[model samples]
Target chain A: MVEAWQWVTKHPDKLAGWTLEHIWIVSVAIAIAVVLGVALGIYISRPGKEHIADSVLYLAEIMMTVPSLALFGLLMLILGTIGLKVIGFLPAVIALVIYGQLPILRNTYIAIREVDPAMIEAGKGMGMSERQLLFKVKLPLAVPIIMAGLRNAIVLLIGITAIAAIIGAGGLGVPIFRGLRNARMDLIIIGGVSVSILALVVDGLMGRVERWVTPRGLKRR
Target chain B: MIRLDQVTKIYPDGTEAVNEVSLEVGEGELCVLLGPSGCGKTTTMKVINRIIPITKGKIYIDGTDTTKIDEDELRRNIGYAIQEIGLFPHMTVGQNIQVVPALKGWPKDKRSERAEELLELVGMNSAEFMNKYPSELSGGQRQRVGVARALGADPPILLMDEPFGAIDPITRVRLQDEFLKIEQEIKKTIIFVTHDIYEAIKMGDKIALMNEGRLVQYDTPSNLLFKPKNEFVEQFVGADRALKGLQLIRVKELMTGTPPLAKADERVVTVQARMEREGVDCLAVVDNEGKFLGWVDRVNVGKGETVRDIINRSVATATANAVLSEALSLMLSSGFKTLAIVDGINKLEGVLSFDAIQLALSEVAQRRGSE
Candidate 1:
């Protein structure tokens, strides 16, 4: 561990670059997951779309049950054949997006579903249009719940981004993968500690954001 | 006035929620749509505002077909409230009340003024509550804000579905009384829904009772009490129908002219003489200005020199506007056969005797039987 600390201090720039890269990849993937999850959740949760919701949730569940590395490898082959970036940042981000889906999508679906039906009826009865109801009532009330899902996705993806280093996406995972190759146990400990710290920081920031966006009406007395 | 002609609602799943119900609520009338749960009372009310589109009939509001008008435009003109209140949790009390007015494009100043005015109208302190969110309010307060929100536009017609159902019993009664006061001042044509028959009797000018998606009986509260259309109504109204009927009748309805009076200054012998001449056991004592002082009973005669000294001051009194049930209870609790009917100033207005109430109910029963 002391040796790894010396090594890290000796290469501060490299460590900083990998940390930024790790953050960027995780953020992009979580952002994509949030948009996709919320939109799909809203569509499936609407009244009179039960069958569509069932089928979509079932497919997402099956996708969730699959092994993450195997799924990432399969995506690499498909993207490689399609002549897209398949080896590094793109494949790694895509894998994280897929992994982040269940938390975001499931939470969004349940949150939107759990909104008081009477409130929606009142909105409709008071002459609010479909679009107005969604924006003014549904989305505002669902924000806290949805934000919680985003926080979960961010933390999960931050940790998963380490695995992406195996596919050539340089991050904190590089040290661990190098440790594995060169039999450096101290480097592996440093990499594991860095990923844990990164998850906590992302989680703490997102929690504050969630608290800020939570509807004032729903705040505990 | 709002009118529904053979309004029916059959969902896609073949559940006929409302079946060909026809009704009319006159201008300024508060009509109650009442029944047990799932009896389609709510569906019947929704059809009036076109919230639940009618499967087979026409609804007219102030002589305009509801279906013919643009739905949003039509709804904007009809106030709606429900049991759960459904106040926008994200909005403050003022913002919740201003929703309809804001939707109609009222200027900011006008909307704010209207919200304050309505909060006061519903008996809330506007300055204290305007900025508070719904969760911060008690259930009863939230219910009041719900009503204020519904009345935001001062719409001529209002639809309320068990608006007070979620409140505690004590608060529910207070809300009901407050609503009654507001109704009298505004006189908007209203269709209120409830399963509690007592609520229907208290709030409705007319009651339309439903069962199994059909209209069972539609009539005034008095008629439903004294002349139920069938056994179902009698059972639905419960065995206390006679006692409930007294609520529909007022002290003024049963009161006759004030009985012969004895002046407070009059001698005890004079009070006895008057009671004797009138063939009654008591005479109401009055002051110089004719305000009721108390009653001088025959038993109190000779107790003192004057009527004031002998007067039974603890004798219960009833107001002219008080329901007969209230007066009756006062009489029963006081062990008196008659109650003094007083005006706001405690002046003698008339007299309400137990015989009069018995006569009124019997007359209603006899009239219904003869019909």
Candidate 2:
């Protein structure tokens, strides 16, 4: 561990680059997941669309059950077939976005669906159109819960991004893979610790964001 | 005025919530839709604003067919409140009250001014409560905000479904009285729904009593009490309806206009002689200006030199505008069969007696029987 610390200090620029790469890839994937997941959640959670919601949630659950490495391999094959880059950042991001779907999608769907029914009734009775009801009432109340899902997805994707190192996507995962190849326990500990720290910090920030976005009326007195 | 010409609502599952109910509510009149649970009073109200689409029949608001108006446009023009209050938790009290006006594109300053005015109209302190959330308010306060929100755009018609139903009984009565006062000032045509017969009696100018999705009786509260249309109407109004009818008639309506009066400076013997001549046990004592002083009973008349010295100053008194039930309760509680009615400045108006209440009840019963 001491030697790994020394090596990290000796190669500060390399460490910084890898950490930034890890953040860049995970951020991109989560950004895409948030937009796509929220839109799909809203579309499927509409009244009379329960069957569609169920089917979409089922598919997301199946995607969640697949091992990250195996999913990446499958993505590689699909990308190769389509003549796109099958390794590095492309497969890494594609795989992370897939893994991020379950939490983001499910949370968005549940949050919107579970908004107080009385609020919707009041909005409609007050002459709010469907679009206004969604944008003003339902979505605002759903923010905290949806943010919880986003936080969960971010943490889960950060940890999963480690496996992207196996396919040559440079990130915090690089040191752990190298440590494993060279049978270096300290290097593996360093990589594992950095990933854990990154997840914790991001989650803490998201917690602040969740509280900030929540309406004052919803906060505990 | 609003008219429902055989309005019917049959849910897709074949439940007949409202079955061809026809009624008319005059402009600025408060009409109460009253019934037990599952009796379709709420369904009847919702159909007017098209919240629940009618399966058949037509509804006209101010002589315009409701179907001819767009649903959102129609709802915007009709104020709606419900039992749950249904205030948006995400919005402040001010924002909630500004909902309808904001939707109609009122300018910001106008919307806010309207909100403050409405909050005051509902007896809430606008400056203190405008920025507060619904959760921060008591149930009664929330109901007040709900009403202010309903009256947001000041639409000519208001629909309220048991707006005070969720409050504690004591607060409920106070809210009912306050709302009635507000109603008098605004005079918006209103369709109020309630299962409480007393609320219907207190708040409605006309009551449309329903049973099993059919209109059993649509009449004044007095008629519902004294002249029920059928057995169901009789039972729904309850067994003690004659007593309840006391709530409908004012003290002045039943009090004798020319009650015998004894002057405060008159000699006791002279007052006693007057009471004896009138064949009455008591005479209301008044000063030279006709301001009520008290009463001088025959027993007390001879006990003092003048009516002033013999006057029972602590006798219970009621305002002329007070309902008979209030007067009767005061009389009963004070152990007096006769009650003095006075105006705002203690001026003698009339007198109420137990005999007069009995006569009123018997007259109603006889009239109903003859019909």
Top candidate by lDDT: 2
lDDT of 1 by residue, B1-371 (tens): 78888988999999999998999999999999999999999999888777788889888887888878888878889999986558988889999999889889999999999999999999899999999999889998999999999999999999998999976875775577668768889989999999988788877899999999999999999888878999999899888766787778767777999799989888888778778888999898888888988888888687899887888888787666566666777888888788998764679999999999888777655655675
- State the C-alpha lDDT per candidate: 0.86, 0.88
Question: After superposing the true interface residues, what Cα RMSD does each candidate give?
Answer: 1.0, 1.0
Error of 2 at B96 (Å): 0.3
lDDT (tens digit, per residue) of candidate 2 on A1-221: 79879988888888888889999999999999999899999999899999999999999999999999899899999999999998899999989988899998999999999988878878888889999899989999999889999999999999999989998888999999999999999789888999999999999999999889999998877
Say which docking band candidate 1 falls in. medium
Candidate 1 chain B: worst 10 consecutive residues by lDDT? B362-371
Where is model 1 more than 4 Å wrong at Cα?
A: B250-371
Worst 10 residues of 2 chain B by lDDT: B362-371
For candidate 2, give the lDDT of residue A149. 96
